[model samples]
Target: MYGFRFEDVIVDDDAAADDLQAHLADAHGGKARPLCMCTPAGVPMYVAKVGEHYVIKRMPNTGGTHAPDCASYEPPAELSGLGEVKGEAIQENIEDGVTTLRLDFSLSKTGARIAPAPSGEAADTVRTDGAKLTLRGTLHYLWEEAGLNRWYPAMAGTRSWYVVRKFLLQAAAGKVSKGEPLGRSLYVPESYSQDNAAGITQRRIAHMAALAASGKTRKLMIAIGEVKEIAESRYGFKIVAKHLPDFPFMLSEELHLRLQKRFENELALWDSIEDSHLTFISTFGVGPTGIASIETLAVMVVSVNWIPFEHAYDKLMLDALTVQKRRFVKGLRYNLAENKPLACAVLADVLPKPVALYVQPPGIEQEDEDALSKLIGESDIPSWIWRAGEAMPELPLPSHDSASPGSSLHRRVPPRLSAPMLLAQKEGPESAW
Candidate 1:
């Protein structure tokens, strides 16, 4: 259990529930800052009122400061594509406890005729200006914020559509996109039950009523759900989302072809793996006839555990990691291209320090390999690299010396500084804690 220090009073997470709740409630909106004592040098955290309860949240961009085993510990931004658009496309308002997003795509259509741009084409390529997020970038952001990117041994077999929907909605609660509350425009399918079908459909229609508004300017809503199938419809093609069986989304033949061409790799990956899931995020609008048509869409392939993966090699690594019961964060490529070098995953339970895991594609170019080496060299975190054609290397084991008082692995408390010290050491002066 993690220990948190609210002023001079330290509280363990496993302490009496009422006591912890009382402490958190008292700490909320107070001058006394809460510190996560996960390391010798405590990491600053904030208390946010989530619904009727108060909860502690890590300070923005301070995830790297906590100990590896801590729940709030995240791999350095430089290890993933999050480094590219942290402050510009995604902005966090610390005072308001909200995140504002700058999107490259439109949320509302203005023309009389609907001609959706093929936004899914930018899935693996660098098509964004780095100042705004693409459809895939938004998906990555939501997945990461929902805590779906991290895996722990205890989490095995605990994830389902119900759990995913809950977390995704929670993540979207305080987010704003295009000056609108994201929760109002985002739809995640609820767990379906035959007895509650009519009520579920009624709620879904009510939530999506904006899309059914009559006018030349049509509003669009974002839908995220698991793919059941993409089969031929009478008009063109329709996407069947799991748990939303009665509400298949329609797409034009052109868009269908574009989707196939754009996400060919993702489709192939999903097809190659058994028990894997294909998740889709799309902007759609309902017509006067009550037909839902997709405007723009993007797809991601995730393991049975719902952790996203880029290729077969990534799945292999994830399988091994899960089998061995190691805790790690799966790295995601938001707007980054396939040619770019980024950690595939980061092992958090390893001793000395967390290790960044990299998978070099088969027959990588010499220039790319050199770039990968340079990236590894620049990082303070140790790395484990596996060339696609070679045998997998053994993962680093947890250190037995971590408990020793004088061991190098022992947590060293840096001299106490002011509360909320923004760690701009790695990211530049503009970086936040």
Candidate 2:
């Protein structure tokens, strides 16, 4: 069991609630104290008031300090895109017991209507680099901050879209985007239910009214949610997101085809991972009738554990590792239009260095070997691969010095093959990463 630290004294669970309240009232002026709780290993934590009680939350960057079985325990940040934007795209500032995040992405974009790209083609949007978060990175970051990416045996069967939507809304509060609190410019539809259907509808309309009021020079806002289905419509294609079941957004046929083609790999990965979710982030405008329609969009698949995956092979490996309670970080393709490659995932908390896992496409030709080797060889850290058609090999044990701290665990880009390099018999480059 973990203990709470009130200033210099440690208190056990029995006295934690009473003691924490007293400490805050006397020392911190009724505000949440910063890192007042410490784990057995001396990792800092904070007390969050839920209702009339306090619950301990792990301090940033110290999630690994908790025992794996602890409720507050989380996998290392290196296992997700969270590590990349910690100080760059996402900044956290603590003041007066409140934690606010200053984000680098813009919640609203103002411009003329964007034309739809041709079917099965990607538009040349801005690159994922620079200081701001990319569309894909924003989804990953939100999932991480909402605690959806962390799991334990106790959470089984209790998670749902409603719970996810609530947590995301809470997490996004006080987040700064484009010089304003993100909650003002962002809209996450409440989960659909018989009891709250009318309330949910009213809330959506009131929030979207701002966009609808923008008129011809409409301002686009960002929306994040699970993709339920995409199908043909008289106007074009309809996208039905999970939470907003009553509200299906319209997409141009040209844009729909582009999404299907560009996210083919993500779709396959989602299919292979049981209970996995396909999340979509889009810049959209609200119609006069309060209908939200997407202009620019991107989709990604996350495993049951909430780590994003790029291919079916990745889903298989992630499931196998997760069952064993091993921690790993999934890779992200920031620049979707680029032909560059990245690893499938990297195992964390291991010794000499973290283990980078790469999956080679099946039925490989001789030329593919050089490319595969070159990609894996780029990493100086110890690495392994699961070649197609072969059984997965045993992972290499971390060397004695593996636990040493350094920046070596950061993500690295892998080598990518162009569309023409793929064999005619296999899935296309877009779907078969």
Candidate 3:
């Protein structure tokens, strides 16, 4: 029960921290707008000006021994060495490799500036004119019931909390759109009150989405409407240009529209005809396999936590989005003939099975067979990908488990492509997950 709030009303920068803490006491659930300052040293600096500064953290730049997030004079003498705090878990990559997350903080203590950009451009980036407090660290931290981020202990996991929620809600929207829900236990926890439990799962999200467009609920609070509410009480929250935490999740109708736009950008296909030429195109899907949720994975890998919701609404909206980019480098390697494109159907039957096995966003079906043929032959997707799909399944695969095995209740999709195919030739190198 820890979070911050923002005022549509403006206040002096000096009072920001105190204002944040006071608001935190009232809301005490999730975060609102927090200042994001990235230092040149790659250190991401976050500040909540309390009476002075309550939680000061300086994530380290290297691993091994770690420390508290920041320095202070009041207490814990050892805590002064911010990077000296020992984490709860620390497994070295002694063997094949045990990736232990830790904080590595250091002052680049060198010349830095925000460089100038070319003419006509808004401004220069990565410049040296302005100094920045740089910081970057593996965020494997010590957690106590009363620790700062105890509310979200999973911060050390596969997805950032914001990323998890963004994709979780998005996935929920999709499941509900298909007349399915991840089920009550799988969505927004029941602990949520009417005031905050907007739509935790797909069903709730869908219901809430409808209420938003309906003029009847226009008088209600946005979170109350965006989230689930008792007696239909409502509230107002800022609708940022993109995804932001604490703001309620939009319903599936809204979800799909938003997701589709993201996929285009994420899939790197917003300008259907134009951009396709720039990015390697392929049909990817979220498969019904693995225990980790696709919603969680997609959010971590794609949205990086804060979802650009406004962009979720319109395909026209364009910004150099910061999304986790995935490539079939294996796909590119296996996808011989850079001249030809891949098809969705062919990609569906084959291709990206390895990546699929790991994480799929939640909607690819066997029934879309025609889509396979169309994508391979002549369809909406580019021809280069259409051709790539032809050579997709470079190797034979094990049987797909769409049905439940005797003792197993989980259904799963199999690896459609092989390492050999994924290892095929390519013009340039592709990004690894």
Best by TM-score: 1
The local distance difference test score of each candidate is: 0.79, 0.56, 0.21
TM-score (all chains, Cα) for each model: 0.89, 0.70, 0.19
Q: TM-score ranking from best to worst?
A: 1, 2, 3
Per-residue lDDT for 239-338 in model 2, tens only? 8998688888788887887787877777776666568888787777777686777876778787664556666776787776666545454565443333
Measure candidate 2: CA RMSD.
Answer: 10.9
For model 3, how does the per-residue alpha-carbon lDDT over 352-391 read when each residue is reduced to its tens digit? 1311111111243554444444433532222222122233
Scored by lDDT, model 2 comes in at 0.56
Residue 29 local lDDT, model 1: 65
262 Cα displacement, candidate 3 (Å): 17
2 or 3, greater by lDDT? 2
How displaced is residue 315 in candidate 1, in Å?
0.8
Can you write out model 1's per-residue Cα lDDT over 126-177, one digit (the tens) per residue? 5675788878888998988887888766567777877677667767877898
- Which parts of model 2 are misplaced by more than 4 Å? 11-41, 44-80, 95-111, 115-126, 215-217, 268-275, 304-307, 325-389, 395-433
Better of 1 and 3 by TM-score: 1
